[model samples]
Target: MYPFLRLAKEFYVHRNDPALPLTGTHVSHHLCWPWDLDLWMELNNGRTLTLLDLGRLPLARRVGLIAVMKSQGWGLTMAGVSVRYRRRVRMFDRFHTRSRCIGWDERFIYIEQGMWRGGECCNHALYRAAVTDANGIVTPDRVMRAMGLDVASPPLPGWVSAWIEAEAKRPWPPMAE
Candidate 1:
């Protein structure tokens, strides 16, 4: 289950945080609860993705994205992601999460996030996100303008652009056996 209660706590705790620029990083802390683990006793690969919401939402709040979303009646959605899991995260373990918007293209915004324990990174992920309304996607430039920021998007990094290109070439519907 999604941690809606924890998400609410994050919102309340960060309500007073100052607004951030597009490239600013939002750092937060979290724990791997018993329920977050798999049969093997480490954090489940799927659950790791869900837990990332706790970090990303707070980052959005700090950057004033939530305010814009609310005022414009827009919703955020994760269109895609590429993630790598490294070290194991055991139950009751504490970790620090770092999340930020790297940049955007015509269709989606890109965010980079990592989970770290001690000085080592346990996971890293890049998310392709989109803002939506009753109609469809609201472009990132328009979304930024709603937050009173300029409409210019920083250039996407080479890796991100390559991923976008790769995804473009990938087949959509799977072939029948």
Candidate 2:
């Protein structure tokens, strides 16, 4: 089940919060409920992605991106992601998440986030997200302007640039056929 109620409550709690800078991190705390577990008695891989939404949405809010989306009738979606799960998180365990926008390319924005327990990271992820309009994907520069930021984007991290380069070499449409 989706955490609709939890998201709604979080919306109110962080509603009045001021927007964050492009690189600022939004930290959120969570508990692994019984429903969040898998048959193995640990967090499910699918549910991990779903729960990430709980952190990311608040991040979008803190960055004032949601407001811009609402005003422009835009939508947001993840284009890609690379996540690593290093340890198991069992039910009733408490953890905190840290999410931030790392940088952007011509077509996508990159975000990095992590789940930590007692200062140890159990999982981390890098994501490519796109802002969409009726026409299709919106450029990052356009989005920056909408957010009232006139500054140029920061340089892409070495790892991010490498990933982009790697993606370009990957064969599209699949090789299964």
Candidate 3:
């Protein structure tokens, strides 16, 4: 089951957090509940992806993206992601997530996030996200302008740029065996 209750709790808990600049980081804490585990008794990779929402949505809310989307009839969607897992998170383990928008290009926004425990990173992810309307994807420039920022996006980091290039070369719909 999706952790709707936990997501609601996250929203309620951070409801009054101060607004953030577009590139500012949002940090939220979490626990590795038993249900979040896999057969190996560590955090499930799939659940880790879902738990990330607990941080990303709040980050969007703090940066005014939620409001912008609401007023403009836009929806947010993930276009792609890359995650790296490095440590075990057993049941009852406590950790925190840090999320931020690294930058954007003509069509997509790039976000970076990480899960940490005991001062070490357990996992990290990079997400390519898009803002869409009924017509189609809304350009990042338009999204920025709607949020009242006319500034140019900071340069995307080299690694993120490389990832984008690599994705472009990947076959769409994948090849059949």
Best by lDDT: 3
43-149 in candidate 3: lDDT tens per residue? 99999999999999999999999999999999999999999999999999999999999999999999999999989999999999999999999999999999999
| Minimal lDDT window, size 10, model 1 | 144-153
Please list the C-alpha lDDT of all candidates, in the order they appear: 0.90, 0.90, 0.97
Error of 3 at 143 (Å): 0.3
Q: State the lDDT at 20 in candidate 3.
A: 94
C-alpha RMSD by candidate, in order: 1.1, 1.3, 0.6
Task: Name the candidate, 2 or 3, with the larger lDDT value.
Answer: 3
Candidate 1: Cα lDDT at 155:
86
The full ranking of all candidates by lDDT, starting with the best, is 3, 1, 2
Q: Say which prediction, candidate 2 or candidate 3, comes out ahead on TM-score.
A: 3
List model 1 lDDT by residue over 1-177, tens digit each: 888988898788777878778779988888899989999999999999988998899998888888889988999999999999999999999998899999988889999999999999999999999999999999888887798877577888899999999999988886777
lDDT at 153, model 2: 65
Taking all chains together, each candidate's TM-score versus the true structure is 0.96, 0.95, 0.98
- Candidate 2 local distance difference test against the native: 0.90
List of clashing residue pairs for candidate 1: none
Q: What's model 3's TM-score?
A: 0.98
